[model samples]
Target: MSDIATFARVKRPVVSTWRRRHPDFPAAVSANSGRPLFDGAQVTDWLIATGLGNAAPQELRSELALFGIIALRNRFTPWQLVETLGSLLCLRRLDGRPLADDGANASPTSPPDAEADEALWSALLRRAERIDAEDDFVLRELRAIDATAAPLARLAEDLVESAYDERGAYEWLLAARSRLGLDSLAADAVTPELRSLLTQLTDLGVRLERGESLTLADPHVRVGDLLAALLDDAEDRDRVTVLAADPDDRLTRITRRRFLLAGVSELDLDVQTGSDLEERFADPYLAGPDGPAPSSD
Candidate 1:
């Protein structure tokens, strides 16, 4: 009931009214610990049939994908889901490839079945392990998800297609987190007003740089919003380099992915996970005895 209410953006009583008034409404499919559970697919279909399909198909798909993710939270922590989803989105943006290659190319005409699902999970885990090996934080989160008996890889598969664009995926994931009572996941999310201010600051920086090369750095790079704005307004973007760091590894990775999606080349970017204060003072790019003096702005 709560899930339906959240998805429909309505009150619980409104859902109850629909159940009481609609003759063709779908019934509960099963029960969990005395609580009835309805089939999301059936509910969605009924919603579309009853002139309640205000959400775009893409939005609906993303919402359903989030439902699948939240259902796995009992088996895996919400952070694990966030990390896995972020990695999948990053992989997609970097290349036109799925997180897992199920050898579907080996036999293009083969029908999809249980065997394919198994192969897909295996491939995805293998790739996730590779990523974990490089980043300690990601590795720890992936291990937690792997320890679970639940089929978590399926959640990534369901979400990958709907989250092809980085910015939209980032915002949708934030919304999903809020809906799932996981507001902490987006504690550092940039607000619209902050985004606007960042854009204006970037524009000012670009205007000041003029023809000279500019090196912009954001010590607390949340979602790369500042860097994205800077690049967007830069007239000589090729000469601009971004140095960004955040304490949160997941957010750092997300910032990197967003920058890549924004068409910032790898050579022009330096993103890392660390304390903003330490990064600002100790890093040569930001501030060092032999390096350029850091800007107060």
Candidate 2:
């Protein structure tokens, strides 16, 4: 890992020190709820504008506030949820292929097409890998209960940021192809049933890349499968949220309205118009009454 990557992954130990050294950092990122107009409505509006939706805003705020507890629970792990932001910040250094000079005694001129492909693919793959890696916490938590769909759904929404660029679209296609290859390779090494399962996953990815829904096979769905389908499409995640949310009239109308207006769906909506949304998008395995609960020792 690079120095910055290492720092981000291991920054918890220095939290207190960093806070003392740079107290302004938190205030910069933190929303002061006590301030006027920075209350629930404003916050929810902001999240909605940013594509996060209100979906349990209060719950999210509370959960965020309990960062210390979450850190302790996970042994102070640094969550790198989508490294795209980081990669974008460091794009000049990380987004392109290195030029080799004097190959066979002379540097070969790079094709513009190939150059474009390399630049785009490098950025996308790095971003996706970072996302999957940083989401290790969500994966581990879900695996404990054999439930991975919720986290996959949430990740799909975040993958929306990649949809605006043409390069991002092609790069996402490349990711799907690579993941398909990995699944195929794994299938070749496993038993017949496992092979069949892996093949199904491969097919799901292919279908998703083609802009089709694979929710019919969601029980057998994996995060890799969802990522393949949703990365290049802005509306993919919103559709998932709509379907995953209750199929109620109200939700359906709101989801449809959002889709028609903004081309995306917001999952965490308020009960009425002024309610505080909870953190309902997680794998639910960690919060459900019948699911694993945080231990109180």
Candidate 3:
């Protein structure tokens, strides 16, 4: 209900009033414990019928995607959700080969089949293992939940085709975490204005390089926002080397997945998860060949 309210930009009371007064309002299709879960498609249809579909298509899709994520959260822990979502994005970045043999069989279009579901889960587990074995636990949890893949796959596909690039998708996920009241460590996420400022600073740094190759490092990489900003503005991407470190393993995985989805070549990237302070001081990449540390300012 809160998700719907947020999407419609109305107070929660307004959503309650609609549910109480409207005879044709969509009913909850399922429940988690005692809380009812409404189908996003049904709710969207109701919005369209009530002349309340004024939200932009992109916003609507994002809202629905967030709703689906919340549904998953009801069954999984916060870390599990993050790990699974990151793995899915990574699989997508790998050309969707892990979802199905042809990369087309595992979609919302296909009706749910027991055999197909098993096959999809098997493929996903294998792919997740290849990316990071630690994520296998989350994949197993995901497989145990029936009806997980269809909605997730649909949401992933929408996100891949959406106008927002990988960085935008990461921001959207952080926003969803806050809006959904999910337990998260998203306070460290970079704001849009700050991201823009960082990108501009990277441009200045590139100019200061005087046409030489640019090497960038972020010791406290929260979702790789600064690194991404630098990469986005670099004209000679092949000449750019990015070194980033973060303490959060899940965040580091998400950042790596986002970077891959952004088409950043692995040769130019070195990301690790550990004590940011330790990595900052010990990482050789942070120092230039001239034996001087670069100014972070």
- What TM-score does structure 2 among the candidates reach? 0.19
| Candidate 1 pairs with clashing backbones | none
C-alpha TM-score for every candidate = 0.68, 0.19, 0.67
Best-to-worst ranking by TM-score? 1, 3, 2
Alpha carbon lDDT of residue 128, candidate 3? Answer: 55
Candidate 3 has an lDDT of: 0.59
lDDT of 1: 0.60
Over the stretch 257-292, how does candidate 1's per-residue lDDT look in tens digits? 666556556677678788643333233323312334
Model 1's C-alpha root-mean-square deviation from the true structure amounts to: 6.3
Task: List candidate 3 stretches off by more than 4 Å.
Answer: 13-38, 45-54, 96-114, 127-151, 162-171, 179-184, 204-212, 231-239, 276-297
- Comparing 1 with 2 on lDDT, the higher-scoring candidate is 1
Taking all chains together, the TM-score of candidate 1 against the true structure is: 0.68
The lDDT for every candidate, in the order shown, is: 0.60, 0.28, 0.59
Q: Given candidate 3, what's the lDDT at residue 100? A: 35
